[model samples]
Target chain A: MSFLSFLLGEKKTSASVAKDRLQLILINERRGSSAGPDFLPQLQQELVAVISKYVKINPDDIKVNLERQDSLEVLEVKIEMPQPEASA
Target chain B: MSFLSFLLGEKKTSASVAKDRLQLILINERRGSSAGPDFLPQLQQELVAVISKYVKINPDDIKVNLERQDSLEVLEVKIEMPQPEASA
Candidate 1:
């Protein structure tokens, strides 16, 4: 399937973008660190300390991390996770 | 390295997030397809057709993708590339 066909139904909102930006930088600082699913909460808490200077952040809605990129690493920050049960 | 400290400096505008959503969906469809750098452009071109329905998009600003996650994959779509010389 083409990228467009795949993305056509998904929606993007403004608040979510702000959240993603918040997540990316946090991931960057953690670069070259040990890998695991456990990294997220610590990342989220730290994000709160800094981002509060710019805007009120809803912690439950944040996602910050180091995502693999074809054997490389990508610093990503987002407002949400793909809903687990909903997507499957 | 906490996630927030890394993200505080980088800025994310609305356009970028929409692009990210676009890329993620496209990447999902392309799942398990291949391992190569060549896939990006073909993905980008295809994304333009689908997203244009929502807004006027500048092709130069688009990046539709399949990024990696812990040796796994994460679909991504964004408005631009990290400017090579500017960031490095």
Candidate 2:
């Protein structure tokens, strides 16, 4: 399931707000966790490198982040793949 | 971290297409599997029941979908949480 889907509720709710809310939650959930020892950036970078073989990516937006909740350890990779350019 | 985040890239891309792309990719990624057969819907409903404790949800939109990749099994969920109406 996607984050937007998580926040997206009801036919009345706009997808715009859903996008914003999901981003906030996902970021906070992921960032709030790196309180412990982690080599997450390295791992993220490597994952991006490996996955890039199958997709075109924008390096800067490829976020290698982690989230920590109680005893749970979650590693999240946000890959910003390039959009196809509009053809004139 | 999230599907939208995965498709969101560069300074020029629109969030509109990002939302759509993420939805397709996630649905396809999750639903593309489960070819053999699994009790996914039942699992989804129960999962939603458990998670809804902390969230407001629209039961109908809580899709219990699945996707299967080679040697990889993924259960994807789409939860449509309630949105606060306008203050008007």
Candidate 3:
């Protein structure tokens, strides 16, 4: 808020507070790329393998993408799972 | 955690949950740049103006930096503030 409060040693220094805020924004920008961390492919495989146990799903049915929304870095994963066969 | 729970209609779709996580990471990355948003200059000026009211501070005394640590984006602002004159 105000530096005067900081001068009185109320809580944390103004610099500390500013640093926290600035770093938060920087991290968001870095994660916004659609081609995110190298482990994404592995993550997808693991997800598909786990999800396949419950429903019939093709690997292509799963789609994962990274997006940026103002202060938010969003990961979107979509899956098209087929209905299980009707029990006789 | 598990997609089977999602199929049971517990709360949200797996896609929605994934989206939130993805976006968060992206936002952090975006904000991690040392040469951050264009508004930084204005922000520095405003901060200095506000802080100067209480103590003698030079613009250079304030340093703003953005750094990334794993999933955390840190904004560091260091300011050197002079002590105020003691009142009798």
Candidate 4:
């Protein structure tokens, strides 16, 4: 009966599995610890590369920050776009 | 010569077009103005609904916030997940 109960109770749903994955990803992203690599710098570099294809921009013109506030996980992406040409 | 120059200068590259679209979307998302709908609440609701499938959670347990810090646009999603059962 105990073995049967363990078998029945141990079954995990797909939703639970997804929850576990999301938790792991979010924790890794938030902590930027030894558990996993930090992805923000790569994200910033990619953003710069993509945006640079259209307009000439300095690498410093883009900023990416990941912050935690209370229970919230915030990902901020800032790109200082070039101003349009001034009309005469 | 003037008309030819205008024709040449007026052509927009796909990259520039993509930049324009991204700018518009970001602007709309950041401002939550009349130009476009705010997606944060819907995103929160959807997140709650999805997570609720695996774990029982209150609607207030999740918070979503979009904030602008200088040129940066921040999207924060916070979920207070339920604690696991204490091991015997």
Question: What share of the reference contacts survives in each candidate?
Answer: 0.00, 0.01, 0.01, 0.00
Candidate 2 residue-wise lDDT, A1-88, digit = tens? 3433443323644423211100111111221222334434453444345444434556665554565544333445544333334434
How would you encode candidate 4's per-residue C-alpha lDDT over B17-66 as one tens digit per residue?
Answer: 22110000122111211222334345434434543443345565555555
Q: List, residue by residue over B21-55, the lDDT tens digit for candidate 2.
A: 00111211221122333433454454345445434
**Evaluation by DockQ, superior candidate among 2 and 4:** 2
Model 2 regions lying over 4 Å from their true place:
A1-4, A7-39, B1-88
* Candidate 1: count of backbone clashes, pairs at least 3 residues apart or interchain: 15
- Estimated TM-score per prediction? 0.25, 0.33, 0.24, 0.28
Candidate numbers, best TM-score first, in rank order: 2, 4, 1, 3
Model 4 per-residue lDDT tens digits across residues A1-88: 2222221233445432221100001211112112223343454344345445433455665555555433223344554433333425
Compute DockQ for each candidate against the true complex.
Answer: 0.03, 0.03, 0.02, 0.02
lDDT of 1 by residue, B40-88 (tens): 3454344344444433446776654565432223345554323223322
> Which window of ten consecutive residues has the lowest lDDT sum in model 4 chain A?
A19-28
Docking class of 1: incorrect
Candidate 1: lDDT of A36? 26
Question: TM-score for the second chain in candidate 3?
Answer: 0.34
DockQ of 1: 0.03
Model 4 ranges with Cα > 4 A deviation: A1-88, B1-35, B69-73, B84-88
Q: Candidate 3: give the TM-score of chain A.
A: 0.36
Higher DockQ: candidate 3 or 4? 3
Per-model interface RMSD values are 16.6, 16.0, 23.2, 23.3
